[model samples]
Target: MSGTPATALDFPGEVVTQAHVRYVALPGVAGPLALVTLDNGLDHTRPSTFGPAGLRSLLAAADEIEAHTPAVSAVAVTGKPFIFSVGADLAFRSSLRDPEAARAGIHAIGELGHAALRRIGEGHFGGRKVPTFALVNGAAMGGGLEVALHCDYRALSSDVTALALPEVFLGLLPGWGGTQLLPNLVGADRAVTIAIENPLNQNRMLRAAQAFALGLADVLLEPADFLEEALRWAARVIRGEIDPAAARAPVRRGAVWA
Candidate 1:
C-alpha cells in the first residue's frame, strides 16, 4: 500500500470522506489515510481562511469520522517545495493584527485537531488492527513536526529534511505537542540539543538516516522512493510484523534558551 492510495467503489461512484482540521482524509492502498497538507507552503490554517461558521462545520465534521473512517494503515503529508510545515499560520502571530481573535480561533480549532488526531490513532476501521504512519516529506518544524509526532511511526525524507521546534525564536515553546512528543521520539537529550542548536535554515536539518540514528525515524529512504518505502513499512505493521509504542513528553529544557 502507498500513502493514501485512492480507491474506487464497486459501483465506480466517487467516495468523499471529509477530513478534519486543515487536514484531509482519503483511502490509502491498504486502509484509511489522512494528510496534513500545508497551505501556500506555510504552516497553520488561516483564520481568514476558515470563517467561524466554516470552522464549526470543519470541527464538527469529525463526528462523521466515527461513522465513516476506515482502518488507517498508511498516511503521508507533503509540504510545498520540500517544506513539510512552517508551523502555525503566520497571520496568527502578526501581533499588530489581532491576538484576541486569533487566540479564540486557536482554542476552537486546536480542540478539533486534538480530537481528530486521537480519532485517527484510536478509531477502528474493521475487526482487524489499525496503524498510522507519517511521512515527513520535507522540512517539518514546530506545529508541523508536532503533527508528525502524533503518528505511530514517522519517516523523514532522506533528502535534507530538517525537523525542529523553533517556537523559542518566536518567544514561545511548541504549545501543540512538539515540546513533549519530540523528546519522546528522539529522547530528552537529543531533543533539547536540537532545539538549542537552533539550526537556521532547512538545509541544515538532519536527513532521515540521522533521524533514524537518533531514534526519530524507523528507517531512512530516498525522497524519490519515500512513499513507496512508507507503504512497505505500513504493510509490515498491518501484517502484525510491527508493534506500536507510546511517545513521551519532552523534558523541560533549563537555561538552554537563555
Candidate 2:
C-alpha cells in the first residue's frame, strides 16, 4: 500500500499555545522593547514545543511586534518561567510512516520555522532592522537553540542544563538553519562537535557557562534576575553601547585541542 504523504496526514487539533507580547522600557533604549513570551499554559515539566499552531502563534506575535504603537526599539523572545523551548513536536514527526511523507513533514516544519525566525534574525520589523535578542532562561535544545541563534544576541540563565542540537542522536540533522548558522557563529570545528560529534557521544549538552564560552550565548545571568538582566543588556545593545561583533566573537581554542 502506498504511504500517505506528510502534508496529507492529519495534525492534532490546535493546543493552547500562544505568544504573549509585553512592552517594557529600559533606561537607555529608545522606545519600549517588545518582549514575546512563548507559553503553552502548562507547567515547566511539560515544556513548550512547537507545532503548526505554535508556529502560527509566533508569526502572529511577530506581526504584533511590527505593528506596536510608539514603535519598539528592539525585540526579545523568552519562554515561560524556565524552559525556553524544546523545539519541534517530535510526536508530529513520529506519526509519519513513509520516508517521502516524513521528508514532506520535515520540509513543512522547516519552512514555517524559518519564515518566522528569519524575521527576527534579519531584524525586520515595521520595515526596520529592529534589534532582536533571545533570553534563554532555561533548557533550550534543538529548534530552541536554533531560535536563539536567529537572534542578534542571546542571554542564558545560570541554571540552563540542556543546550544542544541532539538531532543527530535521533537520526536527524539540524534541519532548521542549525547546520548553516552554527558553523558561521562558532567556527567550523566547534560546529562539527556540536552538530555531529556531540550528538553521537550520547548527546552531550552544554551548561550555561559552556554555551557562553562557546560563543553560543552573549551573556549568562542568574535565573533569579535573568529576565531583568537580559532587558538591561538589550538596552545597552540598542543604545550602541555594546559591540555586536565583539558580543558574537567565537572563542579561540588552543592548539592542544586541534
Using TM-score as the measure, the top candidate is: 2
Summarize candidate 2's per-residue lDDT along 55-158 as a digit string, tens digits: 76787887787787888888899998778988888888877779998888778877877776776667677668888899999888898889999988888898
Which ranges in model 2 have alpha carbons more than 4 Å from their true place?
A: 1-10, 13-16, 98-100, 250-258
Model 2, TM vs. native: 0.89
lDDT by residue (tens digit), candidate 1, 109-187? 4554454444444434344435556666776766666666777776666884566667676666666566666775666
TM-score each candidate.
0.64, 0.89
Error of 2 at 112 (Å): 0.8
Candidate models: Cα lDDT each: 0.51, 0.81
